[model samples]
Target: MAISPQELSLHKLPPQNIDAEQAIIGGILIENDAIDKIVGILDQNGEDFYRDAHRKIYKAMLSLSNQNEPIDLVTLSSTLRSGGVLESVGGSSYLAALVESTPTAANIIYYANLVREKSLLRRLINSSTEVVTRCYAGGEKIENLLDDAEKIIFEVAQDKTKRSVYHIKDLIKHTFEAIEELSTREGHLTGVTTGFNRLDDLTSGLQPSDLIVIAGRPSMGKTALALNIAQNSAEAGFPVAIFSLEMSKEQLAQRLLASRAKVDLHRIRSGKLKNEDWPKLTTALGILYESPIFIDDTAAQSILEIKAKARRLTKQHNIKLIIVDYLQLVKGRHDADNREQEISDISRSLKAMAKEFNVPVIALAQLSRMPERRE
Candidate 1:
């Protein structure tokens, strides 16, 4: 379930009342100089061991501390070793040295817990155990929750920064190489091709992560255009998956046959197939079946079902493109008061799925009550 910010605000625990016992427990203070020693050990040994061994230990310590568990060194080491910290960080001795040098009792306890839990080392170093414990005990402050959440946010930011740095460096070095590749035109375009010769030229074929929305009112050949594009792409050796919410698979196939055989779609639908037409239809069917154009004719499919089917097609046949007949007909998981919101969600999900699978998604949509507009 998606969590709203308001609901999250309501879920925080109230602050605990720190009595004499609590104070005494929290007051068993370790010196700042001792913390410097711990820092020295970590600095000398490097960060790799702590990053590996103490990562989980830190996390579990946070969890246990949040639940008000009194932490001890023996228990911390056992938890650390059990959580695979020894193998990750180098050894148990490294964990002990780091913990011994930590500054505050709270930090020492927290670091010990963290090394056992394998929590984030930087967060452990920066955050005070007293502050974390106070928040966990009180549970009323969003600020406290935000502080805890910062660890994850910081890691993500760091990862993104690293990726961006690498990408920028690579881009600088390979700009000429990329230009050369484009100049040479050495690779085949591996996506669905829109049937229009001029459009195909402009796009160099529809690339993956593309959301091509074809919109039209009644009798504007929207379906025909989509079918033509699907057929053309499939014929060009790319696997295609088509979801037919408005028309049956057989009906769509007959339209393909009529298009191929130069017969009338109306006549084919009306069962007026001629004696000569039988041979042409048979030949068309044989060719269409052999091609990598799969069709699903289920009515009023939910977005989840569409996603599942698309994934299956991708896995089974390596489908490179997906075509949904119309977006408004598809249902979403949310119960919105307006149909527009539902449509928006469906469109968003389609775009997300396209990105998720790295495939081009062409979804047909219905225009509002307005005259035709061209892009």
Candidate 2:
């Protein structure tokens, strides 16, 4: 959810430990070695500092550290001066004062931890305040509002830790173990199977965090292809979710039945099934009924709505895959600058959702005929 105006108003100050922030910077100034120790703790967008001046000071320190320079008073003050903000941040006098306030640099670790804890607390309070303000505003759908609240809380959890930079030595064993697991499986696929033999072999199935786009001209069976993959995956005991902006759930169900039961799609749509088709239709019905294939045929759904619903399915059903029938039909958020910008947001949100749920997202798209005209 976007931050509300209510959150920005100076109604009250958020949670902060000024002493801790001061201690961290003071320790780093006193002992250049302390910068190395606290980088992992205060390395986030400087949100860890509640005071604006402290944030600026820490950013300059980070810059010096990045340049392989020491983080002492001489270097930090000079860097701030070069950036033209030394006077605004209280200058050399302030830097010396921070160092004076520090008893010793040995307790830098404890001070850093204190600052981080206060930062997390501040974020929580601000988020909860936003939710409460929205509740009073009282225009959103109850379900959507609830979903928004849940998403905010979950995002706070995702943002809890600092940046991650892993060494390859640690990653190699994890990769090798994954390979071992794949080798023991009969099909030898490392990701969710799309039920296409050649495609699965080439791409090793649809890996988690993959954003697969199926593009074509209209009436090119793009929706059919996606539905088949969803059907096959659900049949294999992997929960699947389908978001259809171009068709109704009943229509999709009929298509799935016609494809799975090997009956004529036109005949099924026209209610012209022959007597022999009954058994095949009945068997397909049982299979599909038993399989865990969920569909939301909401047209013109906003990207946020899609994400909220998808997150819910991921939590409740542990859905292994998500399929958006067509991308151009989904609406972007209302706050977009223009159509082009909205489309960009929609694409990125889809990619982020795939990573968030650790599942494959297949979005269907239509290619403009400009290429054909050019050719």
Candidate 3:
């Protein structure tokens, strides 16, 4: 197929560094030890390479490495030929040139970083362009488009670098060091403190990447409990994020202030306070205002919307805990035909978000009313 001039110009090659890719490959071929360093730097697969030949060559190298085979020019050429891709990858001559191009393996990490950086840039450009095209098409609601655009951009920007396989020796060393650190701190929490001494002691605090669900019937103070934890975490200098699907931001603030000041919620809502209550109210407001807590009271927030906002908060504020006012109120990215399925999808996404951000997520849920009848 032939390409038109306009299309050719518009689709000009994506950001890439072919020389760096070749240098990385050459370095690995020269010294097997360099493979570990290159993998650490790139932390990606052969698909990250820009050129088809380079992709095939890297794939072959990875295969040999995984199989505990040698990765010299001779071995690489034989593997490529056996796979029927030697000619497609420019034959053994290209492999020889790659080795000749790299003088040493010491700088292999730098070369690999260049390749990875170019790949990330290419992803950013592609993602942004797609978002722009969607905006122009006007097929979806503006709000939905905005949510999708933000989701795509967030995924591209916050995508964690791929992890390379680690040797058991390295892992054991890390574990030994961690155990030593824990030994020195007797009775100290290993994770974020939840402000309840008994609960903290039982679970060693709200662990990172954990999804904690607080379930109860109506009038059980689920919101109050979540707010209390958020306040406590924030006061301890840990950043907190709250998604209030059931209440507005103002209402949540009032509740927090009431809890902190030990005042009746009705008095605060009705704006009727005694002379001494003013000082308590002022103190509560000051404390909460100074704490590193953020609230997003977006009613009926979709899982995608929450994830995007949570990622931004994680990047900007380094939040340690995320609280969802209630789980039943959150919407899923795709509306399921059944309500139960929708809730399930939302719950799964929340769990994924917690793991991705490496933060503890506390979600409030309503329990079945069947228990009431059992009594």
Candidate 4:
């Protein structure tokens, strides 16, 4: 009977111990096959050719040998094109030169890296056999085998040391510098400024990865305040992503345009848009669009989906700040008995995501219902 995921065995659990022998055997097979295929291609393609295409082919071969990525005609062509080699050459003549001149040891090294993806390696080897058979004749087998074995050992050792070293110190330092640079600018006009004018005077901008929570009762203009902050940040060349669960993108855009054009929000929402209002709305939208503000109006987005979308935005547009319309609208991953616990989890996750992405997260939250008093 098949075991369920929850009932899976812990005994002999670590795959490292169970698959050690199989891994070693697999590694040997991969290296041997790769060497044989590369040699065969070179043997079939006769020597004594010099061309730009040949140079591209050789460079691509060398890159694959070092990187241990699978080699195919398409990938090879793409790599050559990226390296400005394809533009220099007209055809596959340079590729022919590469197959003819690459050393047997280099071919073996390339195969040694293929141990992880045995099936894919096998397919690549089998597919290229025709080209291999044409270029290479059978060489001294034992000598090539020994060379491949040594190459695998050295490469594996180097990879282990490489994983142990961390080179992120410089990256962290540069990120600190960037945060400092941003902290010197004014953030949003109508938002809370930490209640200290001197500190706000020194550091005009809010630091990145900050979780600014705005709590207020109904009709407190919380959404308006948040939008103003987003607009200010976007206007300052800082990309902002707004997740509005309560409103549609068009509705939110309308509010921003009204704010920028100094028009009343109620007038725009009530569909009493005047003829003179057209120019202001259009001009405001044009300015906001060029300022790098992105809005997502998905109703009731889960925390996981929010995180995923935020990561994509950060990567694609280099988003510097994130704003969520209201915290209560967002649901957490778990189904909790109390609403408070769910809110807590959502808050924690949002804060964690801000730190992970190194961007500011401004979350708007609703206040609890006020107790009624006797008049």
Indicate which candidate wins on lDDT: 2
Task: After superposing candidate 1 on the true structure, give the runs of residues whose Cα lies further than 4 Å from its correct spot.
Answer: 1-190, 274-279, 370-375
lDDT ranking of the models: 2, 3, 1, 4
lDDT of 2: 0.78
Q: How far does residue 371 in candidate 3 sit from its true spot (Å)?
A: 4.0
Tens digits of lDDT, candidate 1, 1-375: 986434553575322221221221222222322222122112112221233233354443433332234445555556656766645654556445544544335444333333322223334433544345556578567875777668656753452232100111122232222111101211445445666677887887888998889888767888898888877777666778888888876677667778866778887889987788876665555555555777877676776557766776788888888899988888664446788887887898899889877999989987765543532
**Total clashes for model 3:** 0
lDDT of 2 by residue, 276-321 (tens): 9988877676566666777887666666557766776787888899
Q: Identify the superior model by TM-score, candidate 2 or candidate 4.
A: 2
Clashes of 4: 12
lDDT by residue (tens digit), candidate 4, 151-252: 655654443332211111221233222111222234453332332456456555556677878889877889988888777766666778888889777677
* TM per prediction: 0.48, 0.51, 0.51, 0.47
| Evaluation by TM-score, superior candidate among 1 and 3 | 3
Q: What tens-digit string does per-residue lDDT give for candidate 3 at 123-160?
A: 77777777677776777788987897788777666543
Give candidate 2's root-mean-square deviation (CA, Å).
Answer: 13.8
Cα RMSD (angstroms) for every candidate in the order listed? 21.8, 13.8, 13.1, 23.1
**Candidate that beats the other on TM-score, 1 or 4, i.e. the better one:** 1
- For all candidates in order, the CA lDDT equals 0.58, 0.78, 0.76, 0.57
Worst 10 residues of 4 by lDDT: 40-49
